[model samples]
Target: MPKPGKHINHKGRNRRFTNPEELEEERRKEEEAKRWRQKRGEVSSEEEEEEDDEASGGSDSEDESSDDEEGKKAKGVSNLIEIENPNRVQKKNKKLTTLTVDVPPEKPQLSRREREEIEKQRAQAHYQKLHAEGKTDQARADLARLAIIKQQREEAQKRREADKKAKEDAVKAKTAQTQKALGKK
Candidate 1:
């Protein structure tokens, strides 16, 4: 049975996206918000830690002795690896660094042009850095042109040197002819 105004059967769109990446991103955002709340003292650290443990599928009470042994072994291995490679420690720290910066007082509002200029400068700098690394589209496109220009310059330099040598050889021949004529006289 259905109402007169409503259809008996209907197709409906999904409420949530089927994309796994989007779902993972949403979860990450929620975790970041929770961390921020904990930092602001709005949520208790103990509760958040418990939630984190549950999310990680780890238990505090069960296998406590086994967890301790595994933790110690992992710590020992990590220490050895870090001692062998200092760069790895820096990289691990970089991933773990939290973006929990202290809020600064609001400054005077910038004009639209000023904001645009700052954005432009930042973009230019980013492009320049990428260009230096030969990672930008423009840099890739310019590589052939740069090589051609370099070849042309080298050819021009070689031509100039050849012309200079020819002139010097002609001058030497002229000097020898004049000296021979004087000797004959």
Candidate 2:
């Protein structure tokens, strides 16, 4: 029976392309194609080889000696030019670049007015606090005295009401006796 989707077996039992050499060659070709794509994108082993080649080729000893000789010749030409222009005066720049900040001296002593005002305010606040404490103590004492007076007045008023009630009861009993005598007549 033929399987679907390009004859690769679902059970993986049948190998149609039977040569092992052809299979290995096909795998090698696939890998080589992948590497070639990576190299074309500058991201593979061949690209790294080219970079190593360029770095090794650019720094030969003959190129280094020629660069050193050119540098020495340029320095010698500058020195010769400066020696020939002997009368050319190098002007000194008069512009100030660095800044010097002037700091004020510290004062250890307070002014007389400030010291006097501070002392005066301190004394005033102290006296005011003492006066307030004295007033508070006096107010508490007055409240205690007033409470005693109110209690005494309440006791006296109660006693007066009791005495008045007793006097009314005595008058009522006396009137009942007068009524009895008048009824007997």
Encode model 2's per-residue lDDT on 54-105: one tens digit a residue: 6667456456545544553242366566554778888976656553457577
In candidate 1 the C-alpha lDDT for residue 40 amounts to: 69
Off by over 4 Å in 2: 1-135
TM-score, predicted candidate 1 vs. hidden true structure: 0.33
The parts of candidate 1 lying over 4 Å away from their true place are: 1-125
| Cα lDDT for residue 168, candidate 2 | 96
lDDT (Cα, tens digit) per residue for candidate 1, span 1-185: 77787874455754755799988999999889878985765665355456756766666634553454454423236656644555654434444357545768689899999999999999999999999999988898899789999999999999999999999999999999999989963
What is the number of backbone collisions in each predicted candidate, taken in the order shown? 0, 0
CA lDDT, every model vs. true structure? 0.76, 0.70
Worst 10 residues of 1 by lDDT: 67-76
